[model samples]
Target: MKIRSVVLAAGLIGFSAVASASSFVGTTNAIGSILANTANALGDSTASTFGSDKVVLQAREDAASFVGSNGDLRGVNLEAALGHIRHQMPELQASDMQLAEAILAL
Candidate 1:
């Protein structure tokens, strides 16, 4: 009976960890979707108003707002985008907005 209780407790602990991980993944995915939608909107608005040439700059501004003051870049593969942006605009800072804009450009 003790062995059975121990096994059940262990199973519950494992299940709890899995649930926590799943929740984290779900939250990350939701945030990513919001960021992507915002980026797309910025790109489309820029293309319509100022033209495609200005989209990158507009994207940067919009992305900055999306990231807020904290500039959290979690759940996004922003490093790769940052590399590309750095190549194009060497003076741009390695901020969350710049990274988001880079992804938007692609």
Candidate 2:
């Protein structure tokens, strides 16, 4: 009977350790998911704040495509995008090169 009790206690402790490990894994996964979600939310908010207008969005797309294809900022698409941005936002203080670089950065 004493041997049986010892065996049972050992079995229970082993099960408890497994359960604790499983719980720790679950908690870590949940925290990782939360952090990823928070980062995504922040990224989306920053993008919206930076280029909320259709013109800016189109320009960024154009510049990105231009840069991707030509590997430089001398494409017609980039030029057109810069022109459109300057036309739309006359108050923008950035130079044409600066605007093109910003669009590429986006």
Candidate 3:
């Protein structure tokens, strides 16, 4: 009886994790789309505007990547993803550490 109860509890926890991840995936997708749309509306198609857009796009990409790949959100595991993100924008990644830290905290 104890074994059966433990199995049932584990199954319930698994189901809840799956449901929440599914919901967060949808939210991630929507946020990426909105960021792209905002970038398009910046009213300046010059190099600077394009550069600004690049930063926004990279952030969106990183957030989406995190949500999709983070089945396990333990601190050490996230370091690799953080490195992957730094490859996209070396300056931003080097200068600003808060973004990735905040993402992991979430």
Cα TM-score per model: 0.49, 0.43, 0.40
- For 31-106, candidate 1 gives per-residue lDDT tens digits of 8887677667644533443344343444544455445654553332344434445666676444556356534544
Model 1, 15: alpha-carbon shift in Å?
0.7
Worst 10 residues of 1 by lDDT: 73-82
lDDT values, one for every candidate: 0.57, 0.62, 0.49
Q: Write the per-residue lDDT of candidate 3 for residues 14-96, one digit (tens) a residue.
A: 99999999999999999877545443433132224223443443444454455455433324434544454456545542212
Model 3 lDDT at residue 79: 53
Superposed Cα deviation of residue 99, candidate 1 (Å) = 12
lDDT of 2 by residue, 1-106 (tens): 9999999999999999999999999999997685455435533533454466555566666655554554454556567766766676677666554555466444
After superposing candidate 3, which stretches have Cα over 4 Å from the reference? 43-106
For this target, which candidate reaches the highest lDDT against the unseen true structure? 2
lDDT, candidate 3, at 25: 100
Ranking by TM-score: 1, 2, 3
- Please tell me which predicted candidate would have the highest TM-score against the true structure: 1
Error of 3 at 15 (Å): 0.6
